[model samples]
Target: MMGLPFFRTPEIETPAEIEAASLRSDRFRLQRQVDWQRLDSIVTALENGRPRRISDEDLLDLPVLYRKTASGLAVARETSLDAATLAYLEALVQRAWFQVYGPRMGFTGWLRRFVGGGWSAAVRAIWLDICIALAVMAAGTLVGWLLVSREPDWFYALVPGGMAGGRTPGAGAAALRESLGTKPGSDGLSIFAASLFSNNTGVAIMAFALGFAFGVPTLLLLLYNMALLGAMLWVFADAGLGWEFAAWLSVHGTTELGAIMLAGAAGLHVGRTMAFPGDRSILAAMQAAGVRAAQVMAGCTIMLIVAGVLEGYVRQLVGDAAARAAIGTGMLLFWLGYFILSRPPRERET
Candidate 1:
């Protein structure tokens, strides 16, 4: 009996005391109702399709009002307010909370920002890397073309088996010429484009994935890729189809090779960041580098997709070599304008 604890009954409020508590809650709400109404009006206007009517000052004050409303709600809960008043405050705070802390823009907004400037800005930031990638690819192509042209037999080593799907060294001049001609219909082009995309995507992804290996693999892959181009050029040149082949390749090469170069640049950016890291730790450098590289890589993927369509579909439908060259030149110029001239908004984007 000494060890056992006694339990006490809960305090029951008198009817008068309950009425007094409700009165106090009413008074509390009346004191705060003006500010709550102001917040409610703004929130309602925003929610009911009049967002533009809300002034900048109102927008700035919104969060402050939200906090005040929330505080009032807490007080209402603790003070035993009437059910109607508590529900009103609860709804006010709940709806206003979205305006205070919500996704300001959606997917379409993001797409607009990215297409307008974010991507080009990302590419421009890594101009040095792009230049280096371009230089390396150019050198590799030169080396491949020179070696194959001089030795002739070096074409086998420069281009792996079945890599040259169309104009290989073994192809006769007549066959090489025929490869550049347009088919009768647009039907085959889509399939060819799909195949081209699949093949190039593999190379692009491999180039990007290898960036973690300190960039040597990326460099080598780019070198090998350009070597194949150079070898192909030589094969066509040997067949007296150099102009036709250049036109054919250039039709898609403007965007296709450009995408590959951008991808290589992104990879090199990652590799260089990992290798050097400057004053920062490798992990910190990589974190920043990854974001920058990813931004560029996103644009690269898009370019590759466009290139695939041009190569597979448009080129197949267009018969004239002159027109193909013009199209190629136009695309190259378009990219130049897109990345270099299209300035980003001066205001910070979310």
Candidate 2:
């Protein structure tokens, strides 16, 4: 009765006939049409003790894809389906649904995917952001050095508020002491998560908002973020905190800085289009760039969440200087290897 082309051939009267139909049924389901009766029959075969076998048709079906029935069947046939497999399948369905029917990968994955595919993509985005940040940092460092060298008294004027007077070498120690004073309660996770979310949202908002003021505003914002970082580091250096501050920052700064840079890059991209609309209309260019920029910003948001989680839980756990240093260095390296060195697919074809 089903409209499926496969069904039109004729119904198999007995279970034996259907068992023989397994391979062809797959073809019918996948290349042809939805055959609910055939699907039911396949399920019945499984329930009755036949080894699971799915057709290419099953693979093509959205419901089957969502359920990961093919994967499940393969796993089940090869070996017993474990709890982990079941859990993974469930997660696949949920994620697939979210990706397809929902709002896409959001601010996080979208931004990350701008650079590459999957986690690797996020890593690439971070790398690009870092390179840009470093360029700014190096330029700032040169300027700071020249300024400090030329006019020692004017160092304080160059640095921003709150940090201008804070003793850096002592800030981490002081912050640590203050952090120690607080009870190691459940609130750490919440605080970290909140910070992560807020920081990411801040980046996204800055990236989008600065575009309205022409490109210069976005570039200034990036420079401003870098200045804050440089100032913070300068304080640490002046205070003789040495590697202690580095280690402390390693816990959260890596991810935070990465996100900020990403936001900056996104902002820069928007501003660039505005400043030099080349061939295309400015609005058209902005829209095109906006879509891509949004993807990168979304990725940055996810990075913020991940960094926040690490800072909240892992940072609290690692009180030792060595472990913190290792983690910080490791994170930096991991990011470097993943982004700068990644051999992505040729963009020309993709």
Top model number, lDDT: 1
Best by TM-score: 1
Candidate 2 has its poorest 10 consecutive residues by lDDT at 1-10
Clashing pairs in 2: 26-55, 30-57, 107-298, 108-298, 108-299, 110-295, 111-295, 111-296, 111-299, 112-299
TM-score of candidate 1 to 2 decimals? 0.75
All candidates: TM-score: 0.75, 0.52
Candidate 2: residue 104 Cα off by (Å): 11
How much does candidate 2 score in TM-score? 0.52
Going through the candidates in order, what is the number of backbone clashes in each? 0, 10
Tell me the whole-model lDDT of each prediction, alpha carbons only.
Answer: 0.81, 0.55
Judged by whole-model lDDT over C-alpha atoms, candidate 2 comes out at 0.55
Predict model 1's lDDT versus the native: 0.81
